[model samples]
Target: MTRPVATKVAFEDGWKAADTITLDETARYRRRMVMTSDNGVEFLLDLGEARLLRHGDGLVLDDGRVIEVHAAPEKLYRVAAQDPHHMLRLAWHLGNRHCPSQIMEDCMLIRRDHTLRAMLEGLGAAVTEIEAAFDPEGGAYGESHGQHGHHHGHHHD
Candidate 1:
């Protein structure tokens, strides 16, 4: 069996602005040591390679990833609590933020599918329900399943 290769989670500490590893406000952290090609972490989005256009009220990740939290509820509440107008915007994102996507609980690390489902299960949802909702063609994207393809299978909690 092939041994697991090492991976670089973040940029080396004490890295300078001029360092070859170029990351802007919305930066995409690539896994260097393991897979240099595939993106390891997607934190901030460097909008069209501009430096001055940095996100102000974003998260400076533990790994210095600089992920821009676009109206994340917890962060929004912290930053703009006093402002009624800004708070309204926060409420909007909370109500309409993508469902399948999971929000991070802490400021440390972001979680993917299985981990996210586990966290959601803690709240009051199931992985199978979410998966079925996203299934194309027959999914309950917006329309309820009619007298069409219906099936069931084993699922893990």
Candidate 2:
């Protein structure tokens, strides 16, 4: 049997989901891929452009079924500073390194990395390991840089 294709994403509220698909941070960003729902329903996610799917977002299939997106729990570091100013400084350091972080009022969440953890600790930030769903900022240039007239790529060594 052919898999149902999801060509659209529904951001508006009030749409009931037939099933849910949990994905990690990396898996949440995609343009075209085959995905399996938590309840075992398989579907194709085929969009015109890659998108950062957020928790609670719905993937609308051609057959009118909606599958909810769930952010899967991941191992991460919760970084906190002595004060707001310190926190901002820490955030700046993280951004300078182009680290994807989830900024919060009291703390920041980042994927677990020994180097980053040591750097943050050296900078006077308290780092604690935890497991939680991560929803990071889309960056200053947004998800796609085409609108900004330039393309910036991230490389990890």
Best by TM-score: 2
lDDT of 1 by residue, 44-78 (tens): 23222222211112323334434321111111111
Clashes of each: 4, 0
Question: Per-residue lDDT for 1-157 in model 2, tens only?
Answer: 8999999888777999999999998999889999999999999999988877877778999999999988888899999899999999999999999999987768899999999999999999999999887877776755741222321221111
Which stretches of candidate 1 lie above 4 Å from their native place? 1-6, 10-18, 23-82, 85-91, 99-157
Q: What TM-score should be assigned to candidate 2?
A: 0.88
- lDDT of all predictions: 0.27, 0.85
RMSD of each: 19.0, 6.7
Q: Lowest-scoring 10 consecutive residues by lDDT in candidate 1?
A: 70-79
TM-score per model over all chains: 0.19, 0.88
The positional error of residue 13 in candidate 2, measured at the CA in angstroms, is 1.6
Give the runs in model 2 whose Cα sits over 4 Å from its true position. 142-157
In model 2, the worst 10-residue window by lDDT is: 148-157
